[model samples]
Target chain A: MINKLRMGAAGAVFAAALAGTPAFAADNADATATAEILESIDVTLVSGTSLDFGAMVVTGAGTVSLDASTGNLDCSDADIVCSGATDIAEFSVDTASDGRTLQINLPSSVNLLRAGGTAGNAADELVLDGFNSDAAYDAVNDEYTLVYDASGTNEFAVAGDLTFDGSEGPGVYNGTFNVSVEYN
Target chain B: MIRLAASRLSCFLACLAAAGTFGIALPVSAQGDLLVAPTRVILDGRRGTEVILSNIGSEEATYRIGIELRRMTSEGQLVEVSREEANELEQAAMRMVRYAPRRITLPPGQPQAVRLSARPAVELPDGEYRVHMSFRAIPKPQPVEEQAEQAQGIKIKLIPIYGVTIPVIIRHGRLQATVALSDPGIVTGEKQKWFQLTMQREGESSTYGEIRVMKRGNSEPVYMVRGVAIYPEVGERRVTLPLSSEQAAALKGPVRIEYREMPEAGGALIAALETAIG
Candidate 1:
């Protein structure tokens, strides 16, 4: 079954190449050779989803985390109070080829600073790190890898821990982090 | 036509409701999703190539392209390296490659080509030099509110920036590599079984392909993984191939493990080992 899917993918690439060859053949009466490489990999984020840790109150200095595999939050610290709904960031990946593996790169750490304030103030920032993901982690190299299924489509989620220093001023804090994917 | 429009409207409303459930004050607009084609590039001469970048999200996104250094570990991970940490060959690779339009703003569902070429320096060594090209989406600034809704406490909004990096390799002169498969064994974990091996690579270039494990008489592979790359920096890469419970049961007795190039690349056999597993 897997081999058939791979062959089908190869046939599609060959058909694309043939489609491009007609242009060259039309320009000349004799046989003309041409080659084209078709795109095989695709990745996109699922709509209407984001990595929300929900709302939390920091009494002193503590951390809150959401599990990637299970969407449960670990807010059992004595210095923090957690409430509301939370979610993990979700992404959908599709590859035309079968048996291909993907390397997922998530940032080691990110900083969420107080909104509408001067940038780069350490006192008003929250640090997010220790990202967890649904993909298999290569402990030796500290990386993550996901394999394409027979259907060539896979979904992965990412969650992380957010730490507060208890000195941050009251207000909304916003930040952005990068997630990268590539053929391994 | 009316139904189509109504369905789209429903989707938009559903998305807003999902966002509101998580305390998001603004409507969700799935931004910064991108797709890059021809994931990795290999430049063997002075000839140039192009990589297609598309904005697959609903909103326009700005992507910043830059060249960075990454070194591969024995475990097949690409770790970012600094300029000072980069060796001479890596630095040379970074200096010679050039690309146009470092920053691009792409509308939703639009694709743009980034043209790139390599110009090897004179008297360059006859080995493979590599650098990673990174495309990162820049996040849009948040709109400032005229009035503060909360006089005390705090709220948080976290946006995920999406990006991808492909290895751009420049092979200057004659380059070759040989690989050997050793230490073939199956490790049974609590919930999974893995076929682990050490791929020992020798020479200038990297070895990239697929690993197939098949029973001696079977014509089909019981376990397979494609796009396994062992870069030049790592002499011996540890490859752990995951197997399902049923596949593991069938992998007993005599088995054959073969590492071959990807099917699209002609599937040439790079290394093979015939062994027995209990």
Candidate 2:
């Protein structure tokens, strides 16, 4: 009987503990400051120019690689017509923090799927290699140090080589990739 | 040249003064490419709140702001979700959150306010709803020269986009939560030791607070983690916090682990547990 009474008492205590305290009484959980400190950062990448490998008329199957450093293209030995502008992809970063050092995150390579060229409109296989940052500070891995100027602006461009299959489709091929920036 | 409002100018000066006085380069403006204030929002069905977003960049930029779903992992990291992955509760939560100025274009040093409001259905159940509002930077069009340089053969384009998100929560009537700490253990990894604690949450709402571990006879806590959230999605979660070498060594004795609601969040004693460690 005594043990039973003790168990009952413990159960009551447990119930009270579970009830604990009324938390939302005043709707006073105003964690605005902490949240602001943790979040609210924004980094924008504005594209100045797309990485244009120019026009290439392929006579035979071969690879065309673009030098990330100079945006120059090296066509395979196959007879090809190179025309138009061969320019690197231009990007500028705008941050709220002026003159702050940031780490830019870019993928080393991305597969740009050709639109409507694949079976059932699936992504066609096109690989972009050698993601490069134009900043004097070399990228440690795929991340580079972005130094904003006094006006809170930093411009960096990424260049890559495009690998194409022998029989390539002639359409407006488009694909999207993600680049992120954060305070190091 | 951009003009700052008198109040904003004062805030800027004050921030600079504070940074100088503290001697620590507080990540005021230098940390983020974008500046947003009022990081989290809590709506009680009164009026809508405005989240201020500013473009601190040098050139013109466009940003897309939208509400996204996120689920908190046991490790306290938020995982973003796609629409198809959202459950019924998450879908309902998304339906209630309303925000405007979905898209904005601003020049350097320009600020805009995105108004957010929660309009819950009258018959909706009493619970806490949450959505992560994302502000993603959109890339402008390629320059004329680059556009004209389009190649005839297989070409590839890779554009990088960046952004941030904050949680907006809405609480309806008469919600409660019960928090209990269990299965406290010490985990030793290759390079670090961590204190793992499992919090069991039972109720309609979530619990937000600080987790503190104090050694007996010591006034100061040996381990403390802030912004710990026990969201309503899970009935229980295991929270693993890395322990400093000193803290891990000190934990070889009797300790008290408590999950207390943040003072800003109401200063309530959510849960407490005492254990002996070797």
Candidate 3:
């Protein structure tokens, strides 16, 4: 049954193409080419961007935080020495439909562990939590909402607070976190 | 030309930092760019439908598709519930929904369809069942350069994985719901005034639509919010709509707040209330 439908669709396209030619034998053809268009929703991480908390030296352990809305870093703790450039994670959402409501979900927390260290080793990990975003928060929904603009594009930034308990190993740490978006 | 050179210098510095510390060149854009059509799905009958998943990024990507259970909180949050913790209805819903090609790899600008159908048991009760379908991009392991072993400084590489989930709903039999709007008031916050109300829902199904507030005699709505939903799991949902100073002033007298179905759903009125706001 599927093969027959495929043949019929191919035949319809061929007949339509032939009918467009000046030398076609038939004056007209009633071939049908049905198309089902689906609404498009695209989510992309902005190029050349990452949630960088910058390089910091920890003495007695404190918090280094970046504000998602303002791109401001708060490293005022006396024990932490902060340096280098920091960035908030950014994403762009585009949809074919205008004014569509979307939910942006960010991980509540993520752990950055020392490279080459065993998983689940607390000594080698730094905890990052208190994830915040620039998206409008819906108190009713307890989630963030990103409404597509007139052009169907919405961009938002995400930031979080990194904390070290003063016992974390000093090696290079690597980790991954997830962000999700869904239609509301 | 100067701007181009500046960007190049930054890029070089970034590469130098990576080499001097981690000894690996971080990906410029490692996360997958994904697109999914018809973010929400409804299966009211036996006919199956296909969801199109497209890879819009520059590199090929793999996506793992799976069905998960989520329950709606009174506050309107969808919290993930493990299979062991799901209720009988949720378990049944998960068992009935079927989809093929649990995973797929797509090249840039290419799209693949994941077909889904629901098969309710013979004795299944008449109600609405819902599950969330998640499409997550599996992260690829970065290749470690030889110099990675020689680098001394401790560096951190944070990879952000991107994913999306759409609610899939199946209505087995007759389902209906009624909504009511109540407790209309004004809340003055630090930055702005907010219009607050509670939506009470009853019956077996869920209600989703838009809320519009208008002055007693005006044709235009003074305040409007779209894509509001009250799932069956919750009896009432408190909604706080942000209002401009002018809108707050205009809403001082008698106003009408109406909750209607989404425009695509024919814009039928679900609930309405008339009250004065101060």
**DockQ each:** 0.27, 0.12, 0.22
* Tens-digit lDDT string for candidate 2 (A43-146): 43343456677666655555667665576778755655566678765555443333234445555667665544563332356666666666533211223555
Instruction: List candidate 3 segments past 4 Å from native.
Output: A1-37, A96-98, A138-142, A151-153, B1-30, B146-154, B188-193, B241-253
The candidate with the higher lDDT, 1 or 2, is 1
> Each candidate's lDDT (Cα)?
0.73, 0.59, 0.72
Top TM-score prediction, candidate number? 1
Better of 1 and 2 by TM-score: 1
User: What TM-score does chain B of candidate 2 reach?
Assistant: 0.79
i-RMS, every candidate?
Answer: 12.7, 17.3, 16.9
Between candidates 1 and 3, the lDDT winner: 1
Summed backbone clashes in each candidate are 0, 8, 2
Question: Which consecutive 10 residues in model 3 chain B have the weakest lDDT in total?
Answer: B1-10
Docking class of 3: incorrect
lDDT of 3 by residue, B51-139 (tens): 66666667899889999998877656678899999999999999999998999987765556688999999999999899999888887
Q: Each model's TM-score, in the order given?
A: 0.85, 0.58, 0.81
Per-residue lDDT tens digits for candidate 1, residues B96-124, read 99998799998765556688999997888
Shift in Å, residue B228, candidate 2 = 1.4
